[model samples]
Target: MAGEQTGVGIADPALEAAAAPLLDKLVADGVAGKLAAQDPTLWGSDAEAEASIRLSWTTLHKSSRPLIGEIEALRTQLRSEGIDRVVLAGMGGSSLAPEVIAATEGVALTVLDTTDPGQVADALAGDLQRTVVVVSSKSGTTVETDSHRRIFAAAFREAGIDPARRLVVVTDPGSPLAELGEAEGYRKVFLADPHVGGRYSALTAFGLVPAGLAGADVARLLDQAALVADAIAADSADNPALRLAAALGAAHADGAEKVVLADTGSGIAGLGDWAEQLIAESTGKQGTGLLPVVVENKDAPGFADAGSDATPVAIGPATGAAKIAVAGPLGAQFLLWETAVAVAGRLLGINPFDQPDVEAAKKAARSLLDNPDALRGTAEPSAVIGAVEVYASAGTTGEGTLADVLREFLATAPEGGYLAVQAYLDRLDDASASLLRSELAPRAGVQTTFGWGPRFLHSTGQYHKGGHPNGIFLQLTGAADDDLDVPDRPYSLGTLQLAQALGDGQVLAEHGRPVLRLHLTDRAAGLAELMRAVQELAR
Candidate 1:
């Protein structure tokens, strides 16, 4: 097995050294022990482990290579068959990875990640007669994926396309998806190894995106990932992922409350979401651990240019602070951030994995589907009903003091409900409109809104950019002095430049949006601020 190895020359001795205490703490706290025991196969002989990891990673990369060939093939096939847009259908890990690949390679791809009827409706709005449907699911039983499969399959019949000619299935060999493909006589079928989880499968059949669309240098990508696997397998604590786990444990022990994972681009954004699930599912438990908080770069015109005038700028201050540390893979700084979040969760005595709340929300949503009228109520039954008066505080103070005030305010407010706007009067047109439209909008009382994940800014970008700009923007910002160098650009220089060009700070300032800026020298302070803000908002 390939053990962890460091990349040649690119290895950071200082980083390894700095992470020593954290690694030691992780080993001491039983986290290292748990992982070691859970997956000893991964830590076996370095060569073997490296080979295994590389095989999987490279497979994904290699899959894309054949994709270029496949693309030419697809183009010819499509041209002869008179097919136009290709619809790739999947959700979560299956869709996110491919979506990233397509976005990065500039392949125009449409993804179906949600079960919302409207989204599905839009995806099928095009010329189904000339469209090819690609249905992907590692498990093959994912309710949403299967639901979409049924929907598309029906649509295929409705459009008069032979199901055999237009449908493609990508899944594990013995999985239901594969079975369905065979039974339905789909023309193309791709199989992923069942051993790989949805997130990890990206490098396998799950990542055969380039092949599916006929774009990208899959071979080179595979080689690079294989090299990374080799390096990781050979190294010890110096291994980026392992070192990250160690850092997370240490930060948690240091009283950090949450892990803030961030990235600069869509590729990294998807990866961050994957990391969130990994940590949340793997380690989140026992009531005393750091929570994972994922952050993404906001979208704006001139976002690609780090130094462009219209780029968004990072506020000098860190807002929405938390105490838990952040870390991710070293090769990719974004990965480093993710790993840091895991490490911080461990240190904080919280599981970095597992999201019970998500399940609860899903359950609630499912129940709502059974009784559509149940959604009519704007407020929870227990919610207190009343009119609210707005008040604004001018002075800013430390978290401890602010938290106390917030707690007092919450206690004094009528138990029924109250909306606490940070400012007495700020543009709230956005919220008001949303309340009138969005099904999930809060009633008269309290609602929490903020931009965290980077991708959401894309969907909501228009509203934030050119729209009425009526929302209360509780902008959260953070900075770490320890910067990584970008492979193509000067590390986060692109990110920094984009931030400035968007005039992100100016957006809030000029719009007169209520803004709260928290400054922190490190991850811990940032998390603290975030928690305080959340609490204040809740209050």
Candidate 2:
């Protein structure tokens, strides 16, 4: 490995020190140069096929230049028609990158990535005549995006606007969505690079179309990424990408595998959330991967509660306590982290390009959607505390006050284990439900991760089942006040949402992971009771 340092953008003394040995070895082996050259052999033979195609994202800064003009033209056409609102329907990276790009650029892009009826209804309730929906899916078969497409088509038609005029589709070249959009006579059909995987597609159409159409300077993002392309690709001791890779690789190697992440007052709004999926789904397989614990802020309970063994990494500026810090423009950060994670995969002895376990939950959800009672949650709750119905997967969480039961459930977290909080509720209306992460983090005394349902199933859901088996799960689902239908599907949004939660829970239980499932019989009352219990436990 080469010695000395020059351009460590993700810099911190402790992290650099911890990463030095691995960074040296990576540099000595010419990993950076090989990865920059798109050498599939870098991640081993098993991952070569995926790595070959996926590496195209590295050149998108130049290859995607043509898209900027097309996107700008579409935006102009939409504006001419008095359509200013842009709603994006996608999942995981397809939705996250665009959301982050638009947010960082101070552009407004409504993102619909959930199966909650209330959330879907909220997205559809806006001015339909003045809104254009960008439906994006890599597979062209994502249930959530397809459902959003159908609902938008129906909503536009009801408003006397031709569906083809207001609905745009983005997908891989020959994907079902591409065909559907073409056949349906949509306003525009953007074919993303088939080589780009959904999670690593920040520089592709998956990240640009919705963002550009929503008014973010998608071209400027490419320019920002270009600024750091050389820095990331260089096989030097100071390569920022290798710096991050070393920190993650060495930390995982040293057994401090849990990565506790914060925004660090960085101008970036949702980078942690976006990077969470990248790290989790990319490396969280083969029974080992870095678990990203994203806290809301420095004040979040996770900062105080996550055990001392966790690796402290910040997104924007380095905080005093951070061992590693990644600071850059949102666009540059995207390319840097994607490259870093790919390199980290080599260090971790895993195939970064393949998500081998993501389909388990999907299959389970499909079974439940097909049979409805395959998992059987229709039975009476194991116990009721206020409006919360508790369903313990295995051992009891102590039948007492909700707070007492919560304390027992949290106490069950194994040594060095983490807590996964999966909430299947309307994120918009029940945004406060997210506070459970902060509240329960201190109580659980473990790195606590919170994810909205169906979406997380596409993100950390992979890690929960595929990575190390040392995690306890907390699932929260609510009774939708009023549910919406899926246009032609047999199931309603509420049913599909619940099925997704239950399906995931079943898989977790099957994997021998402890699960505490709570059903909110009433959204408002149940959340109130849940907070009351969590606060009491904290006290």
In order of appearance, the predictions have TM-scores of 0.54, 0.96
Stretches of model 1 off by over 4 angstroms after superposition: 1-18, 24-84, 264-270, 288-290, 296-539
**How many steric clashes between backbone atoms does each model show?**
88, 1
Encode model 1's per-residue lDDT on 1-539: one tens digit a residue.
01122211112243345557776655455443333223323223432342243223323333445544554566577758777667777755576566655555556667765433334566778888777777888778765566667777777877777777887778877987788789878977877666455544555656554234535444444554545543233235555555655544544444332344433322322444444444444344444433333333322111212121111211111122211122222223222333344445445444332233333323443454444354333222111111111122223221234344344333333322112122111112112211211111122132222322222222222223232223333332223343322223222322322232123334434544333333222334444443543344431
RMSD of each: 15.7, 3.0
- What RMSD value applies to candidate 1? 15.7
Report the lDDT tens digits of candidate 2 across residue range 1-539: 01112133444455567789899999999998888788989988888887888888888898999999999999998899899999999999889999888888888999999999999999898988789999999999999889888888888888888999898999999889999899989999999888878899999999999989988888878887888899888889878899889988877877887888887766877888899999999999999998999888765665534455577777766665667777777778888899999999999999998888889889988999999766454657879877899887688644888887788888888888999999999889989888888888877777889999989988898899999889999999998889998889988888889889988988998999999989999988999999988889754
Best by TM-score: 2
The lDDT per prediction is: 0.42, 0.86
lDDT of model 2 at residue 231? Answer: 87
